[model samples]
Target: MATLAAECDRFKIDVIGISEVRWNGTGEFTNQKGGVLMYSGMPDEQDPHIRGVAVYVRKNVKHSILCWKAISERIIVVRFRAKKFNMSLVQCYAPTEDSPLDQKEVFYSALERTLSEIPRTDVIILMSDFNAEITQSIELGSLFPHKTCHKVTWKSPAGNFESQIDHICISKRWSKVLCDVRNKRSADIDSDHYLVVAELKFNIPKHRYEHPQHTRRTYNTTKLNVGAVKNEMIERINNVSLMEDASIEETWLHIKTNLEEICKDTLGYRKNEQKEWLSANSWELIAQRRSLSRQIKKAVKSDKRNYYVELSMKAQAASEKGDMKELFKLTKQLGGISFQSSAPIENENGQLVFAKNEQAEVWKRHFEKTLNIIHNESGELTIPRHLNPNRQIDTRAPSVNEIRGVIISMKSGKAP
Candidate 1:
């Protein structure tokens, strides 16, 4: 699986449809590198793993996946959000040509039904092992001519017989997007079939308007806790010269810029540290224990047990110390919890809004309709005249003392 992922990465493939997964049960899992693998196979209770199909999407492109359905062990379908038009991919491990006619008919009938269910506006791509040879077709045609080796998708063990059984077919409307389709013999998966790669000239449209993100530097303010650093900062501020005749704004800006420069020069930027639930020592112990377990030795077993006890002690110590962050992370890991990034939201028309500007527009429209109230009739509120007419309401501006009193009474740590 790792090798396959590496191959995909090498080729910079974002989406890959795999045939003959041969895994029991249908499910999905994020790999160590964050790539997602969605597979469909026979139920766990039913043994003797046979035909199966799957789709592997790169981590970067995982956000584009809208939904996926495991139709059967032989077929799976995944829908992806694309620019201009969405796309639906159907992966199949079709019955061999030599299989019974009934079986072949059932496979094709199911595929037909699946295709029918997909929206006609989608750019449908059907790929993987079809188990049939196509000499020529009017509706479907190969875009590029390659060497015979690059044309054959599968080969016999003896290296005598070879044919292009696997295929990647796209909707006629999107045929122009496909640049090339050929077999890649370099990808070695220890299978008789070679990897079939297809190139598509897809333009992932950006948001209509994107707010430019500016990276801000974070100074290590913690250094201020040190008496020397605090004194240095004060000394630098005292040494700064202010223009006596400059405007208030100009003077403030000069001081602000100088302070920032002094802090940057003295404190430097904070370094980001990658936090993990377990300590480095604990991870090292775990690696050593794993290495020892591979060897069949009584001494090694005893050492591994010792390492386990040490790891348990470390975890217990963390619990006693009330390290909530580490505890929660460890709990999630034990519970097999995986966190995924949020996907794009749908709009009023039930279509996904992927662009940031478009999403903002949708939100704007939603709030406008939700908050705006239309009143059929207006009612006037009548307040009785001031009860204490003799004590006239003060209409004069507040004095400096009154303003200072109000300022003193106000709470700190609040926005002005």
Candidate 2:
């Protein structure tokens, strides 16, 4: 029991949903430390041995128990938010005896009610030791092909069946199976049967919507704005620390991981003395820190003002010189802005919306605009001077001398 408590402490699990927490009137089990622990089947059942279900939620998560019920002698329903994704995680110990279909109906009904009671957005993770058979025909599809647990929960020394009954179910809205989320059967701890544990992965509510509509460094201009961006990246690096060293990639490759974390923060970073330990010299730590710092740099620059200011000079220069290449490059760089091919914004009104497309298309449109501007500004256009005079040159070409002048003019346009 002490070891279990220490494991829970080491993991920092937000909710420890335990089934069959056998309680005694005078044992140390009376003391529920670290979080709110709710144990059922106490005084009323005349069983001080609270045998059925229990849940311990960490204090900082800010959850009010939305609903709690003992739907079956072996099953319990709990609805709470592990940071806004309100989930209904049931603690079930399936009936040992071959109960009638009528009992199964009640268990299934409770599951249905539990799903309806919680927000659909919040996922349902049904975790239990279901001694009944886990057939493909069984209602739960989400927990299919129970990896490492393709065996029956009940073992009479003969080891008769190999179909998984102990399972965990996830609502379609809450999660999907990835290589990471897993559990395996283990020698039962403090019980006769083997134990099955699941590592469930849920989308943290604050992290789901990560992409910023606009990402300018500061709404206001000051060094503090820069710090705010830097701080946000710092927070991302902090989040990565929670993950095991093997699962994560090198710093640059995992920039998007920090993007979501960066978006969750009001300041975009966490502050601690550890951040101060980040060495400018070590590439490993530097890259890790820099990944987050890049997020801050972007947040600082992700505003309309900073965005426009950064592009203002380029936009004007592109407009003046009629160099489609540089103008297009500028447009490519400014990811979430609209621009026009002609000096008049109206010409490029619909043309200048932000969507992620290939680099070639960006350059293609940029040159098209540049060519158009060059055509309009110089009052001339250029093409291959073909003496063959093919019909492909559908329009008349300006005199070579005039076209040369236009080219020369644009080439010289970049000089201060």
Query: Top lDDT: which candidate number?
Result: 1
Model 2: per-residue Cα lDDT over 157-190, one tens digit each? 5443344556666665555632233333332233
TM-score of 1: 0.49
Q: Given candidate 2, what's the lDDT at residue 368?
A: 75
Model 1, span 1-416: residue lDDT tens: 76677678888888899998899889998776678999999877467888989999987788788899999888999998887888899999999868999998888999999999999999999996988765432122366877776788888997657777899999998899999998877675568898999898875433243353555658999999999999998999899999899999999999999988999988988976645445678657654654564453567668877866765666677799987666655555455445453457788899987667999999899977666544444654333343333665688999999999989988654465
RMSD of each: 38.1, 31.8
What shift in Å separates residue 131 of candidate 1 from its native position after superposition?
0.7
The TM-scores of all predictions, comma-separated, are 0.49, 0.38
Q: What TM-score does candidate 2 reach?
A: 0.38
Clashes of each: 0, 15
Model 1 spans > 4 angstroms off: 134-141, 204-416
Q: Where is model 2 more than 4 Å wrong at Cα? A: 10-13, 22-33, 42-51, 58-72, 82-84, 100-102, 134-163, 177-181, 184-188, 203-416
Clashing pairs in 1: none
